[model samples]
Target: MTLTLPPAPHGGPRAGRHLVDAALWPDVARLPRASALRTAVARRIVERAVRRLPLRVRTPGAAAPALPRQPRGSADGLPTLILHDPGAFFRRIGADGLIGFGESYMAGEWDGDDLVGVLTVLAGHVDDLVPQALRRLRGAWVHRRPASDRNTVDGARRNVHRHYDLSNELFATFLDPTLTYSSAVFASLPAGAEDLSAAQHRKIDRLLDLAGTGPGTTLLEIGTGWGELAVRAARRGARVRTVTLSREQRDLALRRVAEAGLRDRVTVELCDYRRVDGTYDAVVSVEMIEAVGAAYWPAYFGALHRLLAPGGRAVLQAITMPHERMLHTARTHTWISKYVFPGGLVPSREAIARHSAAAGLSLVHDTGYGEHYAETLRLWRERFLGRSAEVSALGFDHVFRRMWELYLAYSEAGFRSRYLDVRQLVLTGRTTADRGTG
Candidate 1:
């Protein structure tokens, strides 16, 4: 059923807050508190960032010339961000730095033909934008992670549903035919190389290879992302059993499995990793650990340890942040947690290694591919905009549309700036003393 909502006011003070979808209101209400002192501090931060921004930013190979930063209008055919109300945008940032930055976008305070590109510049200079002295204040603004958003068995279901269950069609419109949502392994992202589906296949193949999955192999997948991994593993003659908390994903994955005539070899169960039973020769989890709250890190890795057979190997693809940043922001509920992925906490490499050691597992090999993830998001964002009409036909309002765009750009910028990284790790139990290559 299509949900029809009165058009949200595009320009006004606080109208955006009132206009955010009902489910998101709770998060908006929690936006950082306003204060004269904080506003003063924010002013300094904003000024520093703005000053550090390159006045002349070049867009290589573009059809137009370099763009002026924060121009009132397009400069020489190149895109420029026009801040309709500079005061309001700055004030929101003053009130709540990160949250306000996103809300300002939702409120239509800024725009450009290349939103992602503009954000990319800012992301590249994130370190210079904020002074080291002021970084300590980040933890001072204490907003505890919501208890209800914990990754307990029951909490996990609600959090997973909040995003994945929106509509398979919604994801389908943006994804390639493979329906893979995570990063693709593009060996060489030439202008006209193999399409995204082929890259996705390569990525899945890498994970399968890392897990040593093959004929008669019993594979246990901790996250069932539309059954792509399971299908690929089964094609290698591995018996696959994948678990997921998403009902929507499970339903469609089962259908896809049956459609491929691998239903007999593959099992798609509506299950949580913490409660998964039995063991397998290989275990694989892709970008699922981010959703496991920090509090459950031990339990999550322990589950992997217990489930892996003695000679079996495990492959995990995780999104990671810097250890210091992770510790500082782990407890805060940011725009991502509130609007897109609830109860999610990205782990740092240090955290992962520590947890794995605790779980009696060794990180034998690891590889980093942050740039590939940025490209993946860039393609998805372009595809999303190309299918805007279809998206609206699915009942998403304008505010919802802007929110998704910002979410995609935000993630892309993080990777482009080296603020975020994605890793593929191979793990094995450390039975005799210890062993690790990473």
Candidate 2:
């Protein structure tokens, strides 16, 4: 699987610089062909990658026809889009790999016209190249373990630390000031009309609306990031209690609550949701269900149901996939699970509905806002890129910057393309009185 860099078209030093890196150079130098033949092999690998993508993905729009030839020419004299040092990188990512490719991107061993697009293409056609069924079996075997309080708590903290603990300063560079880390809700708004901040505000408003929050109501938020919703609900006259695993989030959220003069009405706890025990008029969990593994969905939902008063309503915003079970070789899922969000798994809509029902909660309303999430990620990506220097200054090197960029952009594409979806579900206990349904 060795691949050597073809000599630059004109034998220029700059052209061969990418291949000179120690990590990749050995494989390139030992490639079993002359430079011309190696170039052809590289083109073939790229073509194979393209072919692995689903047909619809390869041709995103009707106007964009499928590329029939490899090494499509570039008018600007740029290098052809080939996986230089593919063998080395691929070997590094061998057998149940996801984070390695992201690291390689950071190391400048690969280049793409569009990294997000490349990921989307890869994800769409992932089944073609990978043994998905066997991979899932192996992953399940590897992850199978008796559940324990320590394991659950550790998993929760690991996820929180991976994403939320990346440094509040760095997060502020991309996320809105409110720091709502979940999907945003865009209601009655024109497509692409609202910015990330506005969209998140709308999402908070929507959650409050779903919960019927108002004067004299007591609300509880699980996995409350930055406490924006808690503060907002409290301002609306509802007493809010929020739980979070990230110390950073709890600290910032508490400060925000104090600054807003709602400290009396809002309380942020640095603890796992499973440890919290209280009844509220409304209970909301945003973007946290994914961290509750599929094996624990029943218990997770039951906890949510128990936290709500008999007549209380609960709203949840979570990412959902189309499959009945989790995919194994899903590179995006794998990447997030390993590097971005440890122990995260996107449940399918059926799984959520069934689990809610099993927990004595009726799904009164379910709305798909997957595209809005795509839009939200796009805004975050742009903002992150705009603040690249600031992010780099926060102890993140070039590789870290590329990782975050790829994360934001490819996430956006996944949501937009319907490969991933976000759903806001309004659940009410069976004993709850029916309110005006939306």
Candidate 3:
């Protein structure tokens, strides 16, 4: 059955005042004394971050935005700050810290002339922006990834639905023609030395190469993202079985596969990785592990280990964070986990190695390109803003649009600041990695 989407309320239920009332303002109104204290401590650190940030501020075209205490500076590449409700902005941050900061944008409290540049500065100093002593208190003030969002087959379905199933049209407004959702590895940058679709193809081909996929190979793809990779694999004469829990994605992917004339070779189905039984020459998952909650890391990797044929490689494209940061932030649920991706966690390289090793997989090769992600985000944000009207036409409202604007900027900043990274890792059995490939 094809699912029909209702038009967005301005931008949809995920946006507008409903979102603020349901998610943001509650965090505001219910700032307990304990949380406020933490927010206060957080404020001290953020104030320091702001003071030391190499930022330049100026009136927009000799006219400042309708806000007070705006900083004035020259034409350096620094981001220009614009504030609407300074007190509410700080209050939001005081209560929820990072989540509040993003909510402030959604609530029209502040903005930047160059949102990405401003966020990049903040993301760069994120580690230092919060006092070290606060790590001990994080457990006291933060909400953990909700138990309901767990990666049990049923739980995973709900979590994935919250984000991916929102509306394909919503995503279509931003993503390039390929409908590929992961980071695109570009070759160069001048006037489009590499476009998004091209970069996506490069990223997929590189992973397939790592897996040694070839004509007549049997391949298992853990996450079927709109079917681009599966289509490409089938085009190479590889038989592919790709699984996803997202009904919306599965339906569209099936259509795209058939449209490309590869239905015989590529099979897209709705299935859980744990229940999937197969032995394949190659296995690949792209940026799917983030959605795999921390508790399920063992099963997630073990499935790969069990599925790979002798000497067969598994290539996974995953987003990673610093080891220490990962540990510090792992137990705490922040804005991204709550709003963007429920039950999602970005693992550190150390965590990935530790868990994969425990699950009988060994990492043989790995590559990271955070800057490429930043570039990709920059393009997506620009494209979305360009199509802002079209997005509204799809039923998204003002609040939803601004929320996404901040979401994109927040992510771009993470990569620019070196706070986050994306990597493709080639793995095999420890024994296989130790021996030369046959």
Query: Which 10 consecutive positions of candidate 2 have the poorest summed lDDT?
Result: 53-62
Query: Residue 177 deviation, candidate 1, in Å?
Result: 0.8
Query: Per lDDT, what order, best first?
Result: 1, 3, 2
List per-prediction Cα lDDT, in the order shown. 0.79, 0.68, 0.78
RMSD of each: 7.4, 7.6, 8.3
The local lDDT score (0 to 100) that residue 17 gets in candidate 3 is 30
Candidate 2 residue lDDT tens string, 222-245: 887888999889989999899988
Q: Judge candidate 3 against the unseen true structure and give its global Cα lDDT, from 0 to 1.
A: 0.78
Each candidate structure's TM-score, on Cα atoms with residue i matched to residue i, is: 0.86, 0.78, 0.86
Candidate 3 lDDT over 1-438, as tens digits, reads: 111111112322211333354453454333223354654565465555555556543322244322222346634456756554444555566666677777667766567988888888777767676667775665554666677777788989999998898888989999999999888888875327567898989988998888888899999999898999999999888999999999999999999999999989999999999999967888999999999988899999989988888778889999999998887677777888877888888999999999999988878999998888888988899999999999989977777788788889888899888899999999886345544352
Per lDDT, the best of the predicted structures is 1
Worst 10 residues of 1 by lDDT: 1-10
Q: Residue 436 in candidate 3 has what lDDT?
A: 38
lDDT for model 1 comes to 0.79
lDDT value, residue 1 of candidate 2: 21
Model 2 local distance difference test score: 0.68
Better of 2 and 3 by TM-score: 3
| Over 4 Å off, model 3 | 1-44, 56-77, 132-141, 190-193, 430-438
